[model samples]
Target chain A: MNYPNKKKSFQKEVNKANLGMTLESDIDATNRYYLDSGIAVIHKKPTPIQVVNVSYPARNKAKITEAYYKTPSTTDYNGVFKGKYIDFDAKETNSTTSFPLKNIHPHQISHLTSVEKQNGIAFFIIHFKPYNEYYILPIHLLMPLWENQYKEKGRKSIPYAYFKDNLHQIHFSYQPRLDYLKVIQTVFNF
Target chain B: MNYPNKKKSFQKEVNKANLGMTLESDIDATNRYYLDSGIAVIHKKPTPIQVVNVSYPARNKAKITEAYYKTPSTTDYNGVFKGKYIDFDAKETNSTTSFPLKNIHPHQISHLTSVEKQNGIAFFIIHFKPYNEYYILPIHLLMPLWENQYKEKGRKSIPYAYFKDNLHQIHFSYQPRLDYLKVIQTVFNF
Candidate 1:
């Protein structure tokens, strides 16, 4: 397999986080496990990039040299899970008290809202740094916090305690580092 | 909006063809239109990159000096379309007679196959250069061609006549340049 150099760096960065494991690497391992075991078909969506310069070393092969990241218009991970379309973003924050609302964008919130309107499962797996605790917070709950963050000054985060109380906590295991589907089963009643 | 610089030259080369417009530009315009009109929620996925060199010209944001394009593990564009999960890739060819199979990777073909198995709509929009004709070829049709390409002397192309006869043709309009949803409705009964 021709793994991209960026993926290797991403993996290295994940290793540095060392919160049991990074959110991205965990997602990758979990997806591989699920695909192998025939549990669900889920994958991390690639980041959109605009390539400006490339060096053609060979006739058909071109190596991109200059590119800039484009703001994605949708969620990071999405696929069919148990007959329902699943869409979500996985984020990690080091804040001990609260998770910042800045991690998400207005377009993402809008996208999740539409997903909910369409009856698809839309949520996020938020990892609290240092503690290594992961919570699956539904879009319904996140929208209010996101809006309130802007409405109220100096309030742009969700308390870790709030997540512990309201959201379903996903227990990380060796097999599936995030193991969010277990929480999904209970939350969506699927 | 921070547009990526990496695709500048590529887009320029595409525009130089002078057929009508570029696939990338058309996609961007279509997505913007969709967002503005409140149609289906969709976006092109990003390519994750690792910034190897950076020059901090400003205090807040650092400019990337050197970077490499990452090979995406999944498809390019995906989102909720009329309550169904839609996943696909858009590819263009300068060849008037055939579309090269080499443009697609084995992993992508495998991913699309799995998407189809899960009952999600998976397909590709083939843009025929010079003629400016576009066709949406289902994953089922593409898999065979992909396999045949590998087996038969590594034949790396599918003729335009084959696409004309087998695939659903998509008409481009000013509003939605590659307005594929119309073809999607006719093809998938969605």
Candidate 2:
């Protein structure tokens, strides 16, 4: 959402093959690493899209003529880790003072809350691009901030200090890139 | 994949609103029913696709001009159930005698096996459309059959009697149509 344009320093030219890939790819690479080593079976769900119209240009070639991106029913990333069901989303923001709430949809919050109710480990991997900081913000911390949106006592964004103090810091690594699962191990004792 | 034509009487015109919807919708509806009742948190991953070209016909409108479906990296459906991770695919075969091995891709078997190594529940929901029957086939039974495809001991498709006797039966319901999770209770003991 607003996070991409908020940080000019984080912008970089990406290869054409990864047209729609973003912070999600970094997380995917980490997931792939986890999967290959038999550490976890995690994956990023494909972007849900609704193709309204299509045309057959050739015998086996179909060309999409009309389509629209559909809001997904669940968060982006989900899988199993150490027999625990893990569900989460990864986001990047440039805001130094606070991470905007708009980056997450109301449906996604409710969906994660449902997963939490089922006792699945649910959280968000928030990256402050300006500082190159990544933190595992659990659902427990997200709920209050999200609920505050409907009440008067809540601020519009989560402050950087709140992340620094309450959230688990995820270190950057070369192979796994953002090893948020390592943070999960420390926080959830996996 | 050939199951739909195996039985002719099972064929029926699906409503147009479900343009690309397959037998998987019944599973999705079942998942939604489970989610709404706090019974489980399951979802069918969107079909993966590669968007090649797009045109901005208007200021607020964008149309996809070229796209192709990409093979999914994992199964079509997965989620948390009673705190246990569940991963699977749903198939409808009209065949009364043998279910084709071609319905499932080799990589899916590999993906599910990886999930199984992590102690997650992995299986398939195959509907014998002709008999109007559904069965929850566990990964243990699937692995041998999938592996047999590469060896002399395996047949091309699983026999219908094998499903009727070996796999757990999933009855059709008015509310939770497929109710495959119901069978998960007996097999996984969750």
Per-residue lDDT value at A94 in model 1: 79
The alpha-carbon deviation from the true structure for residue A32 of candidate 1, after best TM-score superposition, in angstroms, is 2.7
The pairs that clash in candidate 2 are B3-B93, B3-B94, B7-B94
Using Cα atoms, each model's DockQ against the true complex is 0.32, 0.70
RMSD per model, one decimal: 8.2, 5.8
Q: What would the per-residue lDDT of candidate 1 be over residues B1-190, giving only the tens digit for each residue?
A: 9654655756776666554347867977887787567677677776666667654454434356576656677788776666677788888888888998877887788777777777788898888877888899889888777878668486679988898887888888989887887789899886
Worst 10 residues of 2 chain A by lDDT: A8-17
- Ten contiguous residues minimizing lDDT sum, candidate 2 chain B: B6-15
Q: List interface RMSDs for the candidates, in order.
A: 2.6, 1.2
List candidate 2 stretches off by more than 4 Å: A1-22, B1-22
Compute the lDDT of residue A183 as modeled in candidate 2.
Answer: 84
